[model samples]
Target chain A: METKNDGPKQEQRLTKKGKETRARIVAAAAKLMFERGVAGTTVEDVQREAKVSASQLYHYFQEKRELVHAVILFQTAQVLSAQEPLLSHLDSIDALWSWRDAIVSLQVERQCRGGCPIGSLASELADSEPVARAELASGFMKWELAIRGGLIAMHERGQLRGDAEPERLALALLTALQGGLLLTQVHRETSPLEVVLDAMLAHIGSFAQS
Target chain B: METKNDGPKQEQRLTKKGKETRARIVAAAAKLMFERGVAGTTVEDVQREAKVSASQLYHYFQEKRELVHAVILFQTAQVLSAQEPLLSHLDSIDALWSWRDAIVSLQVERQCRGGCPIGSLASELADSEPVARAELASGFMKWELAIRGGLIAMHERGQLRGDAEPERLALALLTALQGGLLLTQVHRETSPLEVVLDAMLAHIGSFAQS
Candidate 1:
């Protein structure tokens, strides 16, 4: 999704300390940005939240847009890392269901306060900020690829019918998840999400080898 | 979806001239808000864009939040109005596909520039703006109910299997459309929308009794 130059070039060649400091700024920005939108969150807020000096914040990020880019990447990695266990093992229908249950439980734990971090950014910035939009799009592609990989695995394991198109199915599954999360965030209830996921999974099951 | 009071009443009691002026403000605000998010769009921007004086803008809205509420309602009406012809006639499977094609064509016509008007607002304001979130939630509910109505018609006609749950299926269809719209907005491509809708519609067809 990120099409612009990585911006301020030092990200690729940071020293150990520099990397840690940069990561700290990004983590803090991600949290604040998630709670408040990009337009609402300021660089001063990120500096205070990260507890880094102004110079330190500037050292890593030349501008707020650059910092936003890092945060997008950070959120993407965080989301993927959280689901790695279930996503990597989605070689069977049951495994996929487990993944759905886990997602629902996690939402309950959060009291359904925040929607998908990456998705929230995509919604806010995708159209207005070209560079950030590219990064957000790439983040989604990564997520889609992960789901597609699992579906492909299911196909290879003979869990799904030979005619089942893993790419389209995975895309549909992700779409359901994204839509479900959006509704869940709005309603502060998990039922919308559950209904959508159930339907998506049921569709997936229809393709299960009989 | 909207659980809050509509706030600062009298949206229903405007004179013809008052109604036209208010509608102009709402339309201008919606366009600006869609292009630049809520936080990014200021009262001054709305006044300038709407070609109304500041006092005139305030006379109608009282605050930016009130304007946002109106815009939310305006967008809901705009979206529903556009789909009324197709959405109202979703009594057959072919009608639904025609609806999908019409949607895809509209997206291509816009060069996939803007996503769903209501969804765009929801993504930006749902978490931070409680009133707007409630309004957005209500907008989604209205959209969902419309879809559900059509599905119920199908079920009554015995087009779908006895086990088909219109409520859940309508929710799922709406979810797919929302997710598809979000992705389509980000990628600036119609494929994501097409893929997800095709998959969702196919799933619905699975519940069709031969």
Candidate 2:
């Protein structure tokens, strides 16, 4: 047998094909969860959708709930990672407008499917399940922190007015985003999201250095 | 036997005691629902907690699902009716500020449990159940319309800027309110809501005649 490596071997041991299989399983689980809601989705459904054997799926994840938690974390990171670049760099109101556009486009592209994935999950179970709730809370907290850091940077760089309340600004931005997302989901259209995003940008852009 | 009105006849017609009992039952459902969530609550739990017999509860509500729908409407109306007088008479920025303080205190007094009862429920099961979902949608639509109408009147009266998009502004305000509610639920505090509301007032107040 080949010698075991000192590292996790997650990348090396799993063949390129096996890695693809694992990703496919996760994507399949995510799609199913999106359709059925977290509580309704079962491991068997994921396995069937992924076309993977029960043993193989179990080999990848020990328990169904654990796998769901993994899926949640996976999706949470995916959403947060998407905003990394836009949220990480914002030195001025113009930058905020550009970032807001990216956010609106991301939300609009999805056609508001069942609302924000993380918010939807949070509302679904609220704090019913400890692990899921923690994951959900962590996801939102992480997203909020990213925005807060961006605002702080902008404020420190003198791009934002010296009196701007960074924390309150971030909170307002988040609430506007959430409001846009919920309205979009309810109407199953992008108009509401677009309007809210535009108004938000207009409101924020009023502070531009012009 | 005395002539009866319908299902369960009372000693006269809805005595003060009877009305209080009904209100208590609805309040009990709302509290349990906000805590354990709607999906986790059952009629049996409501009956036990409300200390009302199944037959007595049925007299007030046809079934568990119907009871939830009634709760949704009652909660929606409760929220809207409370704001109606204030919003309806809102003709100046100072009045709006007073309204904001009242809202903040209302939410803080209840320990942040006084969320937009309709929004919380709509966020969860609005897409899951058709009938209940429609009822919730209608409830929200009515509440938003009321605000939109109020803003339109204000704009027409020159209290607000003529360019004010009353309808869109109203929707955005509702969305922000819901977002504030979500944050309040997460933080278990009203400060988040207060700050957001204050920021909202700042935004909206900018357009009001000084």
Candidate 3:
């Protein structure tokens, strides 16, 4: 009887440990993925990074695809974290431009290298299957909405112009960053990216009072 | 003597029939890449689509990677072709705006789908190997020069404000498009992307005669 009940009871008992081990595996995978493109990240590499044996890695996730999906979700949340606080403070034009500048400066310093982990993963996963593509799509929707909501809030406060199109600008800003990053990465330089950001900032400033 | 003669003979031998066959193979490969994603495209599927036997396919290209490289070069040329006359005609703000609009409209309609194929392939292939990445990088550099040259021409004609920074603005335009594409593709919408374009256009217009 005890043996029969142990299956469910065993899972419950192992829940904490299971979660920790799973997180370790994902972190390991993410690091490897960033250091070497996803295609270069082998299952064995991930297992070794996590300090787990092959069987243990497979036990947590059936395959590398499943693990990658989990990582996408994890990375999306991390991106959001970086954009917050500053985002929430955009109640005035000063705040918005400051936020804009913050974004531009950060990207310039970083030289638009690497990529948005979520965006990068989405490109890979979307072309493969509808299910995975849907997940990738969800991350974008959520990201866009976060920015849109802030823009709308600023508009309502009279800090933004009455005609300000927040959602549209937000989408465009996101897109430019992505494209700019590609160019910057290819050239291993930042001038082109800076030009785009400078133009955007000037445009955004037009809606704000001096 | 035989080896030298064969090498030169093979280099010169792209007969009409052979050219058509090679074209078919590349077209099939591009379609498969779009539908299945680059990683998912298989040599067998490409051969089937082209309706060629394995021996014939291998005869044309010694390996699948060679076929892919050919496809990339072909696609790079296609994109450049689309932008040519416009690229050469950016002698005024109106020309620049019209050119920008054409690109934005094309992208938004596609819902920011795919991405700059050259850039996408480059990002994925950068970690693939140095030689492959170098080839990919060359394509993007060519693209940048094409636009930068246009901007330089516009400036020479005194169409752009003397104080204006054409190179930087060009980079910004490209960046916004990339980011917008990612956003639109992920969200399955175009409104956000258009907003970014509008903002980008408005920004550039500030430096125009109008």
After superposition, the stretches of candidate 1 with alpha carbons farther than 4 Å from their true spots are A1-9, B1-9
Top TM-score prediction, candidate number? 1
Worst 10 residues of 3 chain A by lDDT: A1-10
The root-mean-square deviation over C-alpha atoms between each candidate and the true structure, in angstroms, is 2.0, 6.6, 6.4
lDDT by residue (A111-201, candidate 3, tens digit) is: 5556567767666555454555676677666676776677677777775687777766666656666666665665556665666766776
DockQ of each model vs. true complex: 0.71, 0.32, 0.48
- Looking at model 2 chain B, report the run of 10 residues with the lowest lDDT sum: B1-10
TM-score of each: 0.95, 0.77, 0.80
Least well predicted 10-residue stretch by lDDT in candidate 2 chain A: A1-10
- Candidate 2 local lDDT, B113-186, one digit each (tens): 53567767777665666566667667777767876776787788887887778787777767777777766665
TM-score of chain B of each: 0.94, 0.80, 0.82
Q: Where does candidate 1 clash, by residue pair?
A: A1-A134, A1-A135, A1-A138, A2-A134, A2-A135, B2-B138
Residue-wise C-alpha lDDT for candidate 1, range A17-112, written one tens digit per residue: 988899899999999999998988999999999999999999888899988988888898899999879977777889999999999998899887
Clashes of each: 6, 0, 7
Cα shift from native, residue B86, model 2 (Å): 3.1
Q: Candidate 2: list runs displaced more than 4 Å.
A: A1-29, A42-68, A106-108, A127-134, B1-32, B42-68, B82-85
